[model samples]
Target: MFVKTMRDDKLSLLLTLIFSALCLLTAYRSMSMIAEVLLFIVLGIVYFKKSSIKEELNQREKLFIFAFIGFFVSALTSWIVGSGWELRSVRNPSMPSLIDLDLPSKYLLGALVFLLCVRLKWCLSPKVFGYAIGLGAMVNGCIAIYQHYQLGYSRVYGWSGIAEMAEASALLAVLNLVLFVFASCKKERIFYFVAIFLACLACIFSGTRGSILGFVVTFLFVGVMIFWKKRELLPIFFVGVLAGGLAFVPSLTLEQRQDTMRFDSAENDLKQYMQGNAHTSIGMRFEMWKEAIVMFQMAPFFGLTSAEIEKKMPEILQRSGSALVGIKKANPNNDARGKKHNQILNQAAKKGIVGVIALLLVWFASFRLFTPFLNTSGNSLIFSFCGVSILFYLIFPSLVGEPWESNVTLPLVTLLICAFYKIQKGQKIGY
Candidate 1:
């Protein structure tokens, strides 16, 4: 059945569309287990088809190879650390068992499934890829509005831990907005503009500072590309979009404004700690990062075993003196209690220097694959936008949350990275 779908391009397109819609709806409904399972099933079916093996190892595949290496290494190290080191000295040894089961499994599954799709060329098209992400953003955006309707403020709406879901939705919104703007470059369609506008609007409501910054950086990148190509009229077109984008800012609720404003402030408790206050979330993250760096410094080569780091957390927290009593009170979901906001720092803390090195290699690999298109002179606007969008999203979000772990953004980044190479190389494979 899946093979039949693969053979029919029309069916493949339809599957992509339906899957896109399902992704968005899942966000709104908060059906993540179902969403993950359904996506896996669909991806599985697409790969099961024994189609043209020659088509498998295209530019897209090569790009994925780079990201896959990084993703695989990160997961492998995380699993090793989470299972061997982090779990060693836990209070209720069984508690570690649950983390060992869920955390690594999701990463492993996502990595394998994405690799299989690239091998099968499933969900590889720029158009379909854009639609899928756009749909997902649309769903989350609707969910944010819905949350505001029910609870009076916008927050993440899915099974993904609140921070992860919010970041993922924000990242996707940035990507979708870029694609939507690029799409506008070719044709003038009101529906396209409206849909993209709504998606960007949702991104604003998400209150994710990283995504907002990512969107701004993406626009700047687009401007550079347009200028490089001497496309003079693009600015007027973009300003119109910017105007529309700005119009929605004042629409945010008071609660939404307050929560999201923390994102804009550089004066979090960290500033107070530097002066003398000592009790800010920023200070805690700084403490975690410093302790992590010390652990890495001590075990620079093999890195501190995850077990060692886990055992040292209490001691580290105590020494840093960044502890707070009611810190957990700010969270409504209760899941935000213990997460380091930096992906790089998290990797260092868990996998030490070795993990950090592996992650850098993965970033290099992904960037290397896309370098060809970025430097090329053809109409690879979609591909260029994808690369820039991922770059900005990762860089900006690293300050806000550790999204590289278990969030949909990681795969989306990989997918876009793969799509850039695939679209460029696929064109030469003779249709």
Candidate 2:
């Protein structure tokens, strides 16, 4: 019995280490996938060893799991009914040609992870996870800063060489926000403070307007919440702000600052769109959103397939006189380049109202879990931060991209939710 218990503990430790690595190494999708597969294998073994499959879960957990499963089912149904197989090549001929199928599979994987964590009690130590994520953010942040120095401040990509600058910046911003909250709650950890500073530098250098806005908004909200509970920390917050501003001053050139602020005026963006100029970043997104809404209207319930969207986009553009003059004039074959930047619209375009409902349920369930710990103490504070971090990801991404489809964002979110659930259930996380 002693030997068996020790073996189980060792297995648990190994799982935690892999999970931590996944949190940090998300820039490499292949690596993250391999780690996730290994984790699932270990979880399967643990599940089989249990005397019974029954495990106690709160209502929120159950709802989240159900919503996740619903999302997968709805996505799969859309793929099948919408005849996704026939249009796979036209959608993306370069890859294996089953992008829609892959998305549903990913969703199922997340659901399984949530179930295993709840049933087998596989929640790892939050402190360990936080440190791992912080370290990862610091490394990525350093890379971004270096890139800005080496490649100029046009746009900086971190270790995630293939991902867009905005996507990478957004991920770092969310991770850094969590670290900031952890540092505030712990108060003694200089590691998190340094991590936050590095992350801020990365955000500034990346030159992604949405990411910068998200980081500022999230931290401002966190600061207010922290100060509401403990007003004495106000001075510390200001000092940190001063330090961050000083550190970032060198990189914040007039051109770079203006580039970041280019999309600030909504009225100007609309004017650019009305003039049929999709060259501007904000203008392109507005045009895409309009196209996405049209696609959603075509099949309000089940959604049009990727092939159908591809087939119809030209007609829609031609009819609306919004042919994305910049893209069309430059490369006629690449007219299908723009994507629905907003998550809700993206889902509505791909899987229709069913997909939208499932996503909404997932968001609702997430908040349901976190709402209780909003004003709690001790470990609950950390859990609340985790909740808020997830909320930020959900909210901020809807403005510019489909964050739910991201390999890094969704899995990390699942792991964090599971960890917080374990804490809420009074399970002692092993260090």
Candidate 3:
């Protein structure tokens, strides 16, 4: 009996480690998800007879699990109807999407791991996690900034395959600044401020329009909250300095400072090249949205299947404008190629009414979870900013970008849900 108990304990520890690693690594392969689920089962069985599950769950814990379940259910519903039509008449059968299956699997496994953490009282403090992520962002942002300057040997290097991934990560670093500035810890505000400033520096240099737009909206929302809360203006001032310092850097050898948004000028010649060589950058997004609308009109019910999306874009582009007729032959943004850029439009095209409704419900549920914190005192200011920042992403990301399946979007959603759950509990039940 002693030996058996020891072995069980070791297995449980191993499972816990595996789950944490999966979360950190963002592994979404089917095999990885299955292995994670099986390990969870093993741990569950080993602990089943030893302790009462009911005793482990509290109201706060229940809220977290329910919120995640709610998110998952919506995603699953969208996927089922969305993918079902395509699966009915398989043609090639060899090139099925690993992502289609892996996305849902990852969400389910992540929810399970998160719930287990809450139940086991292993939840990493948001402050710590936020700080660590913020620090990483600052470093990455600095590197991107260096790269922008075309610094010789001193430039920051990233894997060529994953440079775009840095875009979202850098944005998250900016959000962390917002998170930390609003946090109640009361002592680390200066450190967080510096981190956010560094992130902003990187943003100016990266020349990514998506991150730039996201940051502006996030900042405005955060600005309003800070002002309303009657908080000291010192931190905000520091942020201004950081942004200014990076923007006006005279030492930067790159021509980035000269290009600043004047896409039509000789100094910013890349914009013209983009316009001529790649009709599909931001320009293609506009055409795609119009095409997506026409698609919705054709299939108003369940929308278009994934296969249809894959098949139809070429014809749609031809009808909209031909390459011979002043239109570029190729799109610059690869993510926009298979997607409609707008999530709602994509849903309307992909799953019809069901997909659109499920997505609406998700937004509504997210807002509802965080509403209590919006009106309450104490951390109300910070929570309110965070809520708005998240909403901004939801509304805009779909409008002109397709970051729906990235690692950044999922965690940002989960973070909002977790915060809402915590604030709700702290109010009625007490933390």
Candidate 4:
């Protein structure tokens, strides 16, 4: 019995270590992918070791799960109905067949990870999980700062493969928010302050306008939550402001900051787009959104395939007499021009109104789950802030870009949600 108990404890420790590694390696896509595979295997072993585990999902969790299922069903329907029914790519005939499967498969994998966390709650620690995420963000932040200042790169990317500076900035901003909340709720730690400073520096250097906006919004949200609970905590807020300002000052001198702050350019792009020009960045997004709306109108149920969308774009643009026609004609394989930049519209175009509904339901369920913990103190408050940070990350970036499509953010968010739920339920989680 003693030996069996010792073995079980060792398995639990191994699971915790894997979870930590997952958080630490999030910025590196390849490494994080390997960590996730290991996490699943470890979670499976732990799950099977615990005999006759009871279902522990609350009403909100159940709803979230059901909404995810709804999304899967709708997406699958669209894939089946639209696949092989559209024009084949002359350059790459086998491409469209596998690409459409990306979103659904990602969502399924995320759901699996969430479920495993929920099931094997005993093998997790919320404190360790939070620290792991902060440490990961800190590493990425340091790399980004070095890339921008030392390497003289215009936009810092910090080992986040294929993700743009904006995406990395948004990620660091969200992580910083989580660390701030954790710091406020617990005893002051130098590590938390260092992590937060690095994250802020990275965010500023990355020079992503949308992420900066998201950070401000998240900061306000955290401020309100913290102040509402303890009025005397106002000093901490001031200190954070001072620290963040000092950290961000150096980034303000970067030439990239000017480019990032060009709201006038974005406005001009929109004006150009309205005047039948779609060549600019903001203008191209406007064109894509318009095209997505038209696609949704034509096939309200299970919208057009990528092939159909690409094949039909020329006719559509020519009919509208938009400048996108010339652009599309010059570069027929410009998939970015064809895809929707907004997440909600993108989901609607891909899986129709049903997908939209499912997406909203999932958000609603997450909010429902998070709302209760807001009024609590101690660890619950920490969990609440983490939950709110994830929500902000999900909703804010999805408006301008497909944040969830990344393997890093979604998986990390799901794992954190599981850990937060365990904490909320008063489960004693240890590293």
* lDDT for each candidate structure: 0.54, 0.65, 0.50, 0.65
lDDT of 1: 0.54
Tens digit per residue, CA lDDT, model 3, 60-117: 4455455556545654554565563353223456554433344445455556654543
Candidate 2 off by > 4 Å: 1-8, 29-31, 52-54, 90-97, 151-153, 161-187, 227-247, 255-275, 325-338, 423-431
Sort order, TM-score high to low: 4, 2, 1, 3
- Candidate 3 lDDT score relative to the true structure: 0.50
**Candidate 2 per-residue lDDT over residues 173-229, each given as its tens digit:** 555554554464555346766766776666666666566677667667667766876
TM-score of candidate 2 to 2 decimals: 0.83
Count of backbone clashes, every candidate in sequence = 5, 0, 4, 0
Model 1, residue 309: displacement in angstroms?
Answer: 2.5
Each prediction's TM-score versus the true structure? 0.75, 0.83, 0.67, 0.86
lDDT of 2 at 274: 81
Residue pairs clashing in model 3 are: 302-351, 302-352, 304-349, 342-398
Winning model by TM-score: 4
For candidate 3, the clash count comes to 4
